[model samples]
Target: MQLEEIKETCPFCWSCIWLLVDPSFDQIYTEDCSVCCRPILVKTTISDNQITLTLAQEDDGF
Candidate 1:
């Protein structure tokens, strides 16, 4: 699988950002914030061959 940074609109903050995507099974992968360089959590799913991604702050509980 290739790691690719894709441009996506932040669903929570409504901001534009780049997210890392592993082009297999459309799994949601999390990485340090590209803009703020902070930790984040990403949940993703695929339906109809379209990718849907959600981003949120990574809490210690997780």
Candidate 2:
């Protein structure tokens, strides 16, 4: 698993954060924000050696 560090902003508190992503496959998970402790939905897509990440509220899209 190739790990990469990505700089991103929290969807809730808008705080700057660092996330680790594995560019080997697509994945979806939930994590709490370090600043606000709110649950966040994390989605990662891998294609052509590139990774795309999306962050949203945990309850979103339901």
Candidate 3:
């Protein structure tokens, strides 16, 4: 498994944070903000060895 580091903004506190992601497969999960400790929804997409990360509030879709 390959791990990549990416920068993202915390949805709760709006702080810049670093996240480690595995780009081997597409995934959707929830992670807590390191600063505010709020849950953030994470969507990861892998394409042609490139990883894209999307961050949002945990309750964004519900």
Clashing pairs in 1: none
Model 2, 4-51: lDDT tens per residue? 999889999999988888888899998888888998899999888888
Q: lDDT of all predictions, in order shown?
A: 0.65, 0.87, 0.89
Pairs that collide, model 3:
none
Tens digits of per-residue lDDT for model 3, 1-62: 76888998997898999999998899999988899999999999999988888888998932
Between candidates 2 and 3, name the one with more favorable lDDT. 3
lDDT of 3 at 7: 94
lDDT, model 3, position 28: 92
Q: Is candidate 1 or candidate 3 better by lDDT?
A: 3
Q: List TM-scores for all candidates, in order.
A: 0.63, 0.89, 0.90
Q: How much is 62 displaced in model 2, in angstroms?
A: 7.7
| Global CA lDDT computed for model 3 | 0.89
Quote the lDDT for 45 in model 3: 93
1 or 2: which has the higher TM-score?
2
Candidate 1's residue-wise lDDT over 28-49, tens digit each? 4566765666666787776775
Instruction: Sort every candidate by lDDT, greatest first.
Output: 3, 2, 1
In model 1, where do residues sit more than 4 Å from their true spots? 1-5, 9-15, 26-28, 60-62
